[model samples]
Target: MTLTQRQAAYEAEVLRRWQDQSDGAHDLGHLRRVWRNCQTIALAEGGADTEVLLAAAFFHDLVNLPKNHPERAQASRLSARAAVDWLATQGFPAEKLPAVEHAIAAHSFSAAIPPETTEARILQDADRLEALGALGIARMFYVAGAMGGALFDADDPLASHRPLDDRAFALDHIEVKLLPLVHAMQTTEGRRMAEEGADWLMSFRSRLLREIG
Candidate 1:
C-alpha cells in the first residue's frame, strides 16, 4: 500500500529522531529490528500501508526515556508524542492519530499497553518478536552488556524465582521473556519466524544450562 505524503514524512522524521535519541543497545537499534519484523509480517497480512506500518514500527519503542531506562516502568506516552506531533504537521487525519499513538504507547512490554488496532497488534508482535530466536538472543546479551549486566552465572540473582529487581529482570529476560515469544506472536509469518527463533534460544539455553548448571 502507498503512504500519503504526510505518512511518508511522518515516518522519515520519526526514524531520524529515534536514531538520534538512542543508539546501538538503547532503543534505536531495537526499533529498527521491530521495523524490520513489521515489514516481514506486513507483507503477509495485506491491506496495510507499508509505510504507515513501518512508521509505527519505527516509533513503537520510541516510548520511555532513558531516565526511566530499562525497567523503571514509566508511561511511554512521551515516547509516542514526537511521532504524534509530526503526523499532525503532515496533515495526517486526526482520527488516525489515536490509533498511531495507541500503538506507539502500547508497544512497550513494560507499559503493558497491548495493541488495540490491527496495525498496533502487528507492531507489538514484531517488536516482541525481536526478543525471540537467534537475533533475540543476541539482543538480550547486547542489552545486558550495555546495561553493565554480568555474563552468565548459575548463581546470578537475576535467575531467581521472581524475586529479583530491575537489574535482575534485565539480565534474566532471556529465560523469563525471550523464551516464550515464539508462541506469543500475532501473525502467521511472525509465528513461523518466532518458532525458528525460539527453537534456537531453547537449544542455546539448554547447552548453557548443561554446561553452566
Candidate 2:
C-alpha cells in the first residue's frame, strides 16, 4: 500500500477505537495535525524512518487518558504497547516495531521517557506541537471546561501574585506546561516551530489579559 493508503487505514482504525471517547481535544483532527507536523519535522531533520514515524504518530495517543486521570502518566506507555500489538497484527515490519513503540511511549510529556531514536524524537516534538498556538489555546479551554476549571483568575490572570494552578484555571496552563514545551522540543526544526507558536500564545495571553482588565 502507498503511504496515503496506509495512513488512511490507520486513521480508520483510530476513529473506530475512539468513537466512544468524549475528549474533543484529542480527536481525529488532532491526530491528522500531529501526522502533518511529524512529516514536516522529519523532512527538515532527515535520518528519520517515515514508516516508523507514521505508525508512531497515528497511534501515540491510542490509550488517551484525561489529564486528571490517575494513570495519565502511563498513557503513552500503554499506547506504545497497544500500538505494537496492533501493528503486529497488521504485518508491519517487525524490525521497526521497537522504534515505533519507543516513539509512542516517549511522546507524552507526563511519560517523562526520553526519546532515544530520530523517529522517537521527531514524534515527541510533533505531538507536543499540538499544545501550542491557536490549536493549543482551543484545546486548553476545551480541557479546562471538561475538567470543571475556570477560564482564568479574572483578578490575577497571569498568576503574578499567586501560584500557577492550571487545574483551576485554563490560562495558567500556558505557563505551567505550554511554554516549557518550547524548550523541550527534541529536534531543531521542532524547536523553531515551537518558538513561533509560543510567541503567538504569548500575544493571545496579552490580548486576553487586556480585555479582562
Where is model 1 poorest over a 10-residue stretch in terms of lDDT?
A: 162-171
Return the TM-score for each candidate structure: 0.76, 0.98
The residue-by-residue lDDT of candidate 2 on 1-213, one tens digit each, is 778988999998888877788878998888889999999999999999999999999999988999889999999999999989999999899999999999999998888899999999999999899999999999999999999999999888888899999999999999999999998999999999999999999999989888887
- TM-score of model 1 relative to the true fold? 0.76
Residue 43, candidate 1: alpha-carbon lDDT: 83
Best by TM-score: 2
lDDT of each: 0.67, 0.93
lDDT of 2: 0.93
The predictions' CA RMSDs to the true structure, in order, are 3.8, 0.8
Pairs of colliding residues, candidate 1: 133-197
Which TM-score value belongs to model 2?
0.98
Using lDDT as the measure, which candidate wins? Answer: 2
Q: How far is candidate 1 from the true structure (C-alpha RMSD, Å)?
A: 3.8
Residue pairs in clash, model 2: none
